[model samples]
Target: MTSAAIIPSTDLDRPELRRPMTDPFGRTIDYLRVSITDRCDFRCVYCMAEDMTFLPRADLLSLEELDRLCSAFIAKGVRKLRLTGGEPLVRRNMMSLVRSLSRHLKSGALDELTLTTNGSQLARFAAELADCGVRRINVSLDTLDPAEFRRITRWGELDRVLAGIDAALAAGLAIKINTVALKGTNEDEIPSLMRWAHGLGMGLTLIEVMPLGEIGEGRIDQYVPLSLIRARLAANYTLTDLPDSTGGPARYVRIEETGGRLGFITPLTHNFCESCNRVRITCTGTIHTCLGHEDASDLRRPLRASADDALLSAAIDRAIGTKPKGHDFIIDRRHNRPSVSRHMSVTGG
Candidate 1:
């Protein structure tokens, strides 16, 4: 582990020399997704192989170091923060970090704070997290069938996950159910998942399976496009577009007379990279300019070595300066791309 250097406060005021880099899309990259830990109890097939390698404890960023990085990012125009991981709740004292971040937010440093979890542990942590100022949660649950859930996740915690979802709603956390639509696996469960989420008064998002890293080898053909998902839903349900919602990656629609809405993310067939406005910070403090691209800027070293805000700001500027215009996953071999990182668990989805 490397120790951070302390510097004088006078250096923080220097004007940043770097300029913000904009992609072809007009959206400014102000959102930061931080992966708190790579450790998770359940092994989902889409995110991990049956036999997967885990990062050593010494390799992950310390909580204090993570706080420093996050504080600096907030100062650099990052208003939205999403804490993610193999499952962020698996990190011990995660609520402590959430509390600290809430303080920063209360002080007007951050505008929004959210998290993405597998929901296996949400029942235990939902209330505590709600008290910590986490406003939203995105839970990954592909199937409503218990047998298929166990088969897909390789774990028998389906009941526990459902309980967690109920707890989150009770705790007043805005919930979004994220389901990855795979052809032979969980495609048949889309309507069921949507109906369940809607009945619970929660939003639902169906994501097209993308070819990510080593786990993506046999999963490419399983991607059931968003168009098909919508068409299937239209057969039995009346689909109405919510025009007030802004268009980005997901196509937002609502079922008539239903209180809940649905979202569709078709990255493979319909690229959303043009409207992408987010970057990610890996568990080890590497700044990823794009999710599809693995090349990243190292900010841990400079952040630890300098207390100067200007220097920190400059480092952020440099990271965003390298943000790519768009990814070429369609023409290029995304799974085989040398730049793609090995594990999504550590990278933060």
Candidate 2:
């Protein structure tokens, strides 16, 4: 298959003509997180339940349809795209799509294109992903202990994840480790994980366990604030704040004596919504305007049935136009619990 994207490079991204997708609070929506599939191999306790039901293959946006939607978003001023899922690699032959987007990145149609995975299958696909113009990969690894890993994910083996990390390094892919810092669980392992990630020359991002989706009664107990984790890490080393070069919400810091960088994605305690720049699209083509709220627009109708880029783009713009400034995700959990909670997997967590 040709590496060139079917979309043209010039008119494909007329940023000036497109009205900047500014939310009601004035945060420009430029990052697009696309869920390729809701199917995953491992069921992480924090992210998904043991027995999960995935969407039917027919219900998902076709790869070509996704490409078209991405084209529309790009024209509308989406600068970055991250491929996420229940496990993006679980989708069959995803490299085709990667190659397709890689061409866009190579041609400057996007500022960056990245992928987030559980790393179970990275050992097999790392080299190809690197060769296809994917410069960076983020692997979700909550614990370094084998038993704890098994307990957290309920199925994945730590050895496989380690092998995937090795393969990622072998392929020369810039890597990041995303660990959910659960309150009583893995916060103590922060130093060890930081050391190991720095040893591998990879930056580690500690994400506070958010109240998103259902935690099955473990929500309160699992919520670990970044303050606690930072305090724990501070005992061992000093951390200096660094710039968030990638436009992500993760507040970065340079780990004082090593080549390591650390970041905290505190969705709860630290409200980064003032600079929030992301919008999520589910595998079935629903545009989630904010991860904290349920405001969404079903783009599949216009995207697939009508094949009208104008309609699809307008639908997305409408969703962003009224985007909530901040999610009451934490507040709602404190008082009246909403009857409906969005599953992190379905929303591409």
Candidate 3:
């Protein structure tokens, strides 16, 4: 693994850079999710089309620029930083970036440094990630059946992903399985998937598929509201609502039978945007204050314009000022097109 050069700069220590980022809704934005790359190893039917056109390497921000931009956010009181991607692990020398950002964890400037991965590469990087002050991670796994997994991911191997999950568990990393509740594909597997995840002492989060992009398949056929899933599960199992949150949009409940926690991300059936406290930055340095909206501010220009962060900070402030009260995400037969033209991979999940 290549080691990123760690440079101590006075830019983040400036008095003007210490203010907290607050949105127009009076919510303190402390969480920042950065997509290190738009490239992934899997072509999940809901996330991407079978044939994808990724961004060129030159279009992506270098590790140094990403570090600087993240540092600016850390200075602005971002307590949690999540490195997301089409698959963050697939990026070359990604550990170097993780290593560089681990300094914030040591200095008490950040509360958490983690990532959401597909788990295909976790077997190789889990140990190093655990060494880098990362205590937990979220792995996207839609189905547990080998054949069903392959069908959903399009090119993934179930055994390999399972191996990666085992590796992460052995490396002392708390794993949360993020399953996109697909309508006809894997809806029947929800109970078994939840049982398997909870049986391993891991948390399971069921996410309602959002209408993000055109993935060759109609999203109306794939969209499954979590309200129905929750209601169905409540009838068969004991689901006690809990006020616990892990800093994202998931609402949690305790499963009495499994003695484990289960989370629901109901973006469609329920609008959890009222308490939105995070923003996403694509690999190209475009910051989207709301995921369901196309409103974004370009940070790459300001970042490359000067070595100073004044320009970057001002750009961020302008974006946050216009953060929408909530996103307008709807999926129906009439609306076959995506709400946001950009793929969920491009905007960072």
Candidate number achieving the greatest TM-score relative to the actual structure: 3
lDDT of 1 by residue, 141-229 (tens): 99988888888788647999999999999999989999999888888888878888888888999987766656634665565677887
Model 3 lDDT per residue over 1-76, tens place? 4566655445868878677789988988999999999999999999999999999999999988888889989999
lDDT of 3: 0.90
Report every candidate's CA lDDT.
0.76, 0.80, 0.90
Candidate 1 achieves a global lDDT of 0.76
Tell me how far the alpha carbon of residue 192 in candidate 2 is from the true structure, in angstroms, after superposition: 0.5
Model 2 local distance difference test score: 0.80
RMSD of 2: 2.8
Cα displacement (angstroms), candidate 3, residue 25, comes to 1.2
TM-score of predicted model 3?
0.97
Q: Model 3 misses residue 201 by how many Å?
A: 1.1
Q: What is residue 103's positional error in candidate 2, in angstroms?
A: 2.0
Residue runs of model 2 more than 4 Å from their true location after superposition: 1-19, 331-340
